[model samples]
Structure formats: C-alpha cells, structure tokens
Target chain A: MKQNIYDNPTFFNEYKKLRESGITYNDFIEQPAVKSAISCLEGKTVLDLGCGTGEFVRYCLENKASYVLGVDISKKMIEQAKIKTENGKADFICAPIEDINITDQKFDVIISSLAIHYIEDYDGLINKVRNLLNYDGVFIFSTEHPIVTARKEMDNWIKDGEGNKLYWALDDYHEEGKREQHWYIEGVIKYHRTISTLVNTLITNGFKIEEIQEPQSTSEGLNKMPKLVNEKRRPSFIVIKAQKSCVT
Target chain B: MKQNIYDNPTFFNEYKKLRESGITYNDFIEQPAVKSAISCLEGKTVLDLGCGTGEFVRYCLENKASYVLGVDISKKMIEQAKIKTENGKADFICAPIEDINITDQKFDVIISSLAIHYIEDYDGLINKVRNLLNYDGVFIFSTEHPIVTARKEMDNWIKDGEGNKLYWALDDYHEEGKREQHWYIEGVIKYHRTISTLVNTLITNGFKIEEIQEPQSTSEGLNKMPKLVNEKRRPSFIVIKAQKSCVT
Candidate 1:
C-alpha cells in the first residue's frame, strides 16, 4: 500500500491545526505564490492532485473554474473537504493521486499543492498528468524544495549554543530516493529529487516550463511573522508552472 | 567596467596552476558533465562564451566543428587561447562576453564552461544568446550552482572542531546580485542567482530547456580523487542545455 501519513490520526490533527492557525509558510509564502501563478480560471476545468481539505479546489471554484476535481488519499481529509465545500462545481475523490483513473475527462489546468514529494514514481505521474491535460493545458505544482528534503535527518537548520540558526544543513542531495523523517509523527516518507531531475523530468515528459518560483517571504509577510525572515536563508518550497504544447 | 579578475597576474597564474593540475572540480566534475551534454559537433558553427584559454573551443574543433569563435574579457587569457589554438577555423576575441558584437553570425551550438556566474546581467545575456542562435540551435553552458554562490562569504563548508565538514552553509539564496569574495586573490566578483531566475530567464527569452545537469562525481572520478566524494553533498555547478524553438 502507498504511504498515507495524512490519514494517520495524529498527523491529520496536527496538520489541521497548523493550517487553521493561518500563521504558516503555506499561508504567507507558498499559497500566495501558487495563486499568483494561476491565470484566468474562467470556464477552465481544473484537476487538483492531493487536494487536502479542498482549499485550492474551493478557491478555483470561487475564481470561476467551470469544474474542479480534487483527489486526496486521506479519507478523513476528504470528509473535511466535502463538509467545507458546498459548491456543485467542486468534486472530491478519496484515492491516492497516483491511482486516480479519470479517463473520460481532461483538464485545462492541473495543480497540486505541496503534495508531490510523497510520490515515489515521479516520471509515471508526470506522464499520467500529461495524458490528462488537453492541448495547450497547464500544470502547476508546489513541493518541498530539494534543499529542505536533501538531508536524511530532516533537521533543516544547524544552531549554535544559544539556539540561533547558523546555516541550513545540506547533504545527500544527489542521492535521490525515499527519505523517511518525522513531522508531526515518526516515519513520514518523502522523496528527494534534485532541481535538475525535477526540470528534466517535465521536459522529457513533454512539458514546456513556463515559470519557476522559489517563494521568499515578502516584507508584509515578514512583518506578520518575524520568524519567516529565515526564508531568505533557504527556500522551503519550489513552485513550477509548465504548459503542454499545442502541437504535442 | 566588467570584473576582469582573470587578467590579474596573481589570479591568472593561480587559476592556470589549478586547471593544469587536472585534479580540480573543473576537470573531475564539471568538464566531463558539460562535454557529455554536447552531441555531434561535426560541421557545426560554435561560440564559446567567457572562453578562458579556449579549452572548449578547441574541443569543439577537435570533434569536427566547422568553425569556432571564443570570447573572453581577459586579455591575458585570450592571448593564451590564441597561442594554444593554431587551427585556421578558430578565432579569438578579447572582449567581455557581455559586450560581444557578432551580429553578423549565428552559431549552431554555443557552449560556455563555468563562466556565467561572473555575469551581472543574466537576462540581457540570455536574450543576446537567443538572438545569436540559428533556428533550432542548441545553447549549453555551465555556471557555479546557486547553492555554492548563495553565501556571501563563499566559505562553502561548516566544519567541526577537528576540521571535518559538518554541512554546507547556505544563506542569502534569495538575494540575487553581485558577491565579492576571496579566491586566490581577494575580492573576486561573482553573481548569485537562484535556480528559478536562471531557468525563467531562458524561458522568458524564448528558449526551450532540453536538459539540466547538476553533475555528481562518478566512481571513476572519486577513485581518481577521493575528495570529489563531497560532490554528492552539494553540486558545485549547474550545466543546462536549451534549444531555440524552430517556430520562434
């Protein structure tokens, strides 16, 4: 079976609490950047992979997307999403994003928010996403940056005696594979891939890269959360926008 | 004026010594990876940007390139390149790569080896390169990886009491601009650019990225130089191959 750490009760609870707090990297940095990358959603069909709690799905619907389908592995998260989203245009699937079988539908835009690192077969998923996209369609995603995922320990920062962060600890960057680490609980699995692999995999799978954003906290964001100043030292996430060629 | 540290007698002599040693990162890690990215050179017109000593220019000619032009800012380096290249098809220009004026000619393949980091205006250079390529022409170049260039100090590793490297010290990654640091001589200047900026600059300038390689040391390379094993911890260079689309 695929790793479903989000379905774990402890992880689910902690993740929900973090998101609800609204003082997260997601709220201040990643969410704004990802939202900015999406163009006009009017009349466009969207597929949201690993859509936790259907936040982006609801946002897409609010932005006038004709239809938005969200896929999540966590049944608890899907239940929460169904409860939160009352719009008829939004739909949720409680299945692993990798195993989602939507043969009858192709989307104008496919987006995933901070959920791709859980995927073990990156190329396979990319190929599947390619087939699921219409001509000239777009795919945008955000994932844990390779620098953050590089170290096996997942202890991102090295601190001095006074607990001041000295620098980000980067190692095993080229050793791409499963990295098991702790988040809210133990044995949370994530795959580590270098930036080159990420870019080349998209190109090899026939995606034309449009933009790449390593989101940095803005002045307003820093003012709201002073600790976010550390974002300048190392990016925690990488957001990419790629398009399928019309001829392809 | 553009930074011409390569013309400094002390710096040039030291750099020459390093390249001649055949044990440097350029030899073991970078050169091999950059060369591997270039395909058939037969009958191709080539441009070597920041072509210190014209090493890649000569390699292209040896691989049956019909013509090669090398541009460098350092007079001393260009003089050495002229002396080293005796082929009639090879030409040298002593000018900053950023200021090269070869509007009359278009190249089939343009390659640069470990020189782009010194350039302050990345977008202008990419735009110029796009205009300099023939339809469907390939542009391949290598530069100091953003991770290596991120820190202002350029003191890559953080070591323990016994002088063992604990981890790479990464900071100032989001800050993209000129960075002055010490090499053989003090105050060598290089520009730090995030991977996002590097990739987006090309895409914005109408280039389709073909491949991006963050070269790691192979078993043979490590066998030749044991210290090269550290390359796995972090990439020192990023080599990218991009093509000018035919329709564009």
Candidate 2:
C-alpha cells in the first residue's frame, strides 16, 4: 500500500500551515529554483506529479500551457487543488504517482517538485515517466539533496552550546533504503539515495541530463528569511532538467 | 605553469612510500574501484592522463592494449614510469594534461585516476578529451569526491572529545573554485566542484554517462585497513564511466 502521510489530519494541517507561511524553506529556496528550471510553457502539455494543492498546476496554466494534469495520492490535497483552480485547462487525479494510470496520455513536459523522495520505487517511476513523455519531451524535478537525505533524520545537524548549527551530520550515506523520520507527527517515510544512484537511474532509463542546479537563496529570499543565508553552506535541494532521447 | 607538487622530493617520497605500503586508501579502496570500471583492453589503444609511475599504463599493456600513452605533468613521475615500463607498446609524455597537443591522435579508451581535481579548467580538459576520443570511445576517470574537496581542508571531520570523528564538516559546497590544502607540504592546490557541475560538464561535452560508482571498501580492503570503514559513512572517491556518443 502507498504511504499517505499527507492524508493524516495533524500532519496535513501542519504541512498546510508551513506551505501558507511566506518564510518556509520551500518558499525561500525551492520554489524559485524549480520555477527557473521550467522553460516557456506556452502551448505545452504538462503533468505535475505529487502535485500538492495544485500550485505548479496553476503556474503552468498561468504560463499558457495548453493543458495541465496534477496527480496526488491525497484526496484532501486534490480537493484543495480543485477548489483553488477553476480553469478548463487544469485537471486533477487523486491516485498514488506509483500507480497512476495515465500511460495513455503523453506530455510535452513532466515535472515533480520536492515529491520524488516520497516514492519508493524510483526506477519504476522514471521508466513510467519516460513512457508518458512524447519524443524529446523534458523531465524536470527537484528532490531533497542527497546530503539531506543521506541520514535517517532529515536535516541532521551538529549544533553548538547555543544551538547554532555547526555542520550537517552525515551518516549511513551508502545505505540506500527507507528512512523513517518525524515531521509534525511521527513516521514520515522517505527513501535515501546517493547522487550516483539518482543520476545513473535517469541515464539508464533514457534521459539525457541537460541542466542541474543546486540553487542558493536569492537576495530577495535572504532579505525575507535571514536563516536562508545558511544555504550557502549546504544545499537543501538538487534540481535536474533532462530530455528524453531516442528510445534505448 | 602547471602545479607540479608531485615532483617535490618530500611529496614524491611520501607518495611513493604510501603506494608501496599496499595498505593505503588507494591500494585498498580506490585502485580496486577504478580497475573495476575498466573493461577488456585487447587490441584497444589507451591513454592515461596524470598517469603516475605508469601503474594503469602497465595494466593496460599487460591486458593486450595495442598502445598506451601515459601523460603526467611531473618529470619525475614520467621518469619513474619510463624506468618501470619496458613494453614497446607503452610510452610516457611529461607535459601538463591541460597543455597536451594530442589532437592528432584519438584513443579507444582514456583513463585518469584520482588526478582530475588538480586541474583548474575542467570544462576545457573535458572538451579536449572529447576531441581526442574515437567515436563511441570511453572516458573513465576518478577524482576526489566533491564532499572531500568542498572545503579548503581536504578532509574536514568534526571529531568528539576523544578524537573520534563524529561527522564530516561540509561548508562552501556550492562555491566552486581553487582550493589550497596541505598534503606532504603547504600550498598544494586543487579545484572544488559540485556533483552537478561534474555531471553536466560530461553531458554538455557529448559523453553519455554509463556508470557512476561511489565504491565501498571490499572485505579485503576492510581487513587491510580498518580506517577504510569510514568510507561507508561518506564516499572518498567518485568513479565515472562515460561513453562518447555521436559528435555534437
């Protein structure tokens, strides 16, 4: 069965609160970086995997995509997305990304933002994405940086007496498997994969990596959230843009 | 002028002793990993960049490579390579890898072992290698892992009160530039680059990433050097095997 931590009431409430907050890491660091990877969306068909609340789905519609489909496992999230988005160009599907039955549909671009780490079978997902993309289509995604995901405790840091983060405490990096950690509640599951595994999986599945970014906070972001300055020390995310090459 | 720390008597002597010890990281960890990336060499022409003392050069020749050219910036290293290698199939060139004028010759395989970080212009070097490779040629190389080179200190480990390493101190990881550290002597220079930069450079240069390995210590390695167990916590090297696709 698919893990649906997003459906948990307490966790969903806390996550919704965090997303609404203007100063969250996703707001200050991830969104800008992910948006930058996206090219002109005019007339393009888009698929947003793990599309929570349809933020990117709306962005795609705003950017003039011909059509956009948002997929998420949480019924609550899909309901929220449907309530917020009223455009005919936008559609929502409440299904686990791992089991999405959208193979009949093809997309000009497929994007997933900060959601890939939640999926257990990364190779299968990549293969599915490859099949769902039209020839020369693009697959762009942002995931928690391997450095952040290498340990069981997400964002593991060594702190000083005064609680200032000294450095990231990295361990069990080579051990690739399920990592259980607590967010607002206990037992939020994510998989730890090394950078090599991430890149090699895409290459083996017929994606030609085009651009990669480990984005730092913008000046505006730093002005808004001073703690974001620490991003210079360690990246919180890794974004990759790859094109589907000739079928292998 | 290129950095030739390898020719410094103190550094050279120290390095020679470490390689001869057969219990060092290279002997127990890196060599085995690097050699595993290499395939059958029968009738293939090979080039070894930054080939120190002709180890890989001899390996290729012994495996039936038609010709092997070993290039190093250090005259002393090339001299040692010459003195140790008597095979007519092998030749040594004492020139900076950055300055080698080898556009006239192309090789079936180009291998560099743990020497890429010393070069400044990575993009230029990769372009040069691409041009010097036969179509469908393979370029396999290993370098200091980005995590190790991210800081000015080669291995910045935060240790406990009793000197037990707690975790790696990772900072300035996104900052890509020249890094100066101490080896056998002061002012040893190396370049720092993120994993994104490394992978993107290869992709942009028309090489399809075939395999990327962050190798763990073998059981044999663990028996020889117990310190190598730390490699599981964090990788010390990254080995990549990239194949040159159609010229682009």
Candidate 3:
C-alpha cells in the first residue's frame, strides 16, 4: 500500500483545513531563505515551483515582478492559496512538480521552498525547475542542512567546554539521488538530499550557485549560544540562491 | 577597582591567545557578513570597533579600502592583531572602548563583531562608535540576536515531538558587561539587545538601518532532512549591517 502521509490523508487535510481556516502553519517562503531569493527575483517573470500556499508567489507578485505562477501538487493548498490571494496578484496551479511543463514560457526567477524535499526524483525535479527559467534566471530554495541529516542520531548532541550544549551531528550529506524512506508523524512519505548531491544535481542540470546562506537561529540561536559550541558548526538549514548560468 | 581589563584580564588574555595562536574563531565576523560589509567598504577608511583580532580590518585592507584601523580594549588582542598584520595593511589600538577618542581621523566604515556585548554602557559605546564615523559613512556589525536573549528560557531545548528525547539545552548567562555572572557556566560578559533596541540605538546615535539578515544555517539547513526541533522555531543569529545617514 502507498504510504499514508498520515494514517489518513485527513491529517494533512485537517492541517490544510486549519491553515485555510485563518490558521497559518509554516510558510517556508516567508522565511529568510525566500527573502534571500527575492534579491535575484526583482523585475523577473518568476515561476514558483512547489509553491505551496503561495506565500513566495505573493512575495514575487508584490516585488513588482513581471508576473508569477504559483504551482503546487496539493489541490487544497492551491485552493487555499487562491483564497488567500484574493487580490489576484498572481496565478496558481495545482500540479505535481514532475508535471510542471514550462516549455513555451520561460521565467527569470524560479523558486521553491520546503516543498521539493517531498519529491523522490531529485534530478527530475531539478531539471524541471531549471527548464522553467530564462537565461541567467535564478533558482533559490531552502532545505534542511545536510549536516543535521548526516548526524541525525538523536544522541549526537553534547555539551561544550562552556557547559553550553551543541549538536555536531551530520555536517553534510549528498549522494546522487540517494533515497531514504521516511514515515512522517502520520506515516506520510518524505525524501531528503545532501548539500553536495543537491548542488551537483543542479550543476549537472545547468545551474550555477550565486549564493548560499546558512541561517543561524533566529533570536533564539544567539541566546542558545551555538557560536561557542564549535566555530565552524552552523545551524541545520541552508538557503541556497542559485542562477541558471548562461555559460552552462 | 577600575576593572583591570588589561591587567591580568582573563578574557582579554584568552582573546590574545586565540589571536596570537593564529586561530580563526567564527566569532569575529561571518563570511557572508564580511562580503556584504566589504561591498560597502570599497575605497573607504574603515574602523573596526571592538576589532577582535582585526580580521575584518584585514578584510578591509585586502578589499578596496583606503585605510583601516582596528580598535580593541584588550592589550593582548591588539598585540596579536599587530603581529598578524605586520605588513601594515592596517593599524591596531589597545584601548578601552569608551576611552578611545578619535576626533581627528574620520572613517568611512565602522564595524564591530561579537564583541560589543562586553560593553555595559551601551549608549556610550554606541556614541563612541558613531562619533568615529565620517559623514555618510557606515557602521556595520554582527551581534547576538536580541530575540534570542529575551524570548528563550534556559529550559527551552530541542526535543522530539514526544518531548521525551532532549535534543539540545540552552544554558548561558551573559549580563552585558558584568564579568563572571553566575550562569551554569563561567563566561566574561554579554548584553542582550532586541532588534528594535539595536535599531533604536543606532537611530538614536545618529545612524540609520540599511539591512538586516537573520542567517539561516549553512548548506546543511537546506539539503538535509530530519529537521531540528528548533529549525522551524527560532532564528540562529542576526546580522545587522547598518549605516550612518548622510542627512543625520
């Protein structure tokens, strides 16, 4: 049997319902990752791949972009996105990432948020995301830092000399399209990638890295004092903003 | 007790040791923050207040800066900083933060690192740093995000959804300029300022806010899976790169 995202789709449905009912969970696009992505997006015709809930799409719309297409696989997410963006600032589409065919129309900015990790076909997803971009158009998205994934054993955390604790878990994990089956809290399917593999796949698929941001904690990390734990040890998430290279 | 900072000063000595040993701690400046700051430092005389080891001073020198001066309260740190750049790319001063009066030579860029928290007289420190800047010059620095201090509790930690497994614990007390506060650990001193406080301090001191970046994690945050308990919860740290307004 295909794994249930939760024992029932009702959970995600409920989650989406909750979000739609004036309750917003995490809008990954509103986070700093997407903010960094906006630098390359101004004045570009953008395609938001896996544009769940349309937060980023709206950002693109508000930033005076030529136009924006918010695409997602979840119909409910699309409906909620359409409802939330009642101003009709941008367009929304309900389609799997694999089915996003932008052969005719190209975009100057293409992006995704925390949504791409759910897709198992890594290269396919990247190539599809790449195909939607115009020359030098950039792709920016964020994911769980690979180090956190590599050192994911719950016991990897330890205290430092200052008696302040730290998690030195996986520093980076990347292998070409390696698959790890995940059973979400409700038994939903999830997939993960490492930094190297993800970047390599993008390079192979014709994208050049313009910038990558490793976000520390919000107001929280500083108080937590992760800086002294290990100097090079950063947080567990990275926001990557890459350009579709004309050279490539 | 005049606060013997240079006399048998342990934190100063530690900073000197770290610098003299040619150690590169992540504390002084972040790479992206450095790049962003340097972008604004071109052809300018840069002053690094609280210049821990003077790494950013060196960066300014290597970049398009006309001149660079690094000031620190620690004698040993200044000594090491001088030794590190004997080629005279920059100059260093070993003086207390408040005592360094520079009315003659104005700087185009003034910066600080994770060092300003050691200052108890936040207003005085801000004034001194501000006074050092030339008209329309900038004062850019990175500090511990204030939200980290105000919102987080010592018991707030990362855990699995079940809350049974402890992922990480936060236990650090830095009472901003009070040496040897009784935390669970021993540390020098630190002050906590929220984002608004930081902005207000800069504005009140005749500076203006240019940009603020709450860093995400490294490549790890983006590529990996098995998110940290705090990944979605808090920012790790904040990088505030501000400027001295020409009008003000």
Please compute DockQ, using alpha carbons, for every candidate against the native two-chain complex: 0.89, 0.70, 0.03
Candidate 2, residues B9-117, lDDT tens digits: the string is: 9999999898878778887778888888887899999999999999889989888999999999999899999999985999899999988898578999999998999
Per-residue alpha-carbon lDDT of candidate 1 for residues A171-230, written as tens digits (9 for 90 to 100): 888989999997899999999999998989998899988899999886777988999999
Q: Which pairs, if any, clash in model 2? A: none
- Candidate number of the best lDDT: 1
Tens-place lDDT per residue, model 2, A1-248, is 99999999999998998888867887778888888888789999999999999988998998999999999999999999999998699999999998987757899999999899999999999999999999999999999888888876665777899999877677778888898888888888988899888988998899977778888898888998898888877888999888898857
- The TM-score obtained by model 1 is 0.97
DockQ, candidate 1, vs. native dimer: 0.89
Q: TM-scores for chain A, candidates in order? A: 0.97, 0.97, 0.74
Query: Per-residue CA lDDT of candidate 1, range B16-36, in tens?
Result: 998878777888788889899
> Using Cα atoms with residue i matched to residue i, what is each candidate's TM-score against the true structure?
0.97, 0.95, 0.47
Task: In angstroms, give how far residue A83 of model 1 lies from its true place.
Answer: 1.4
User: What docking tier does model 2 reach?
Assistant: medium
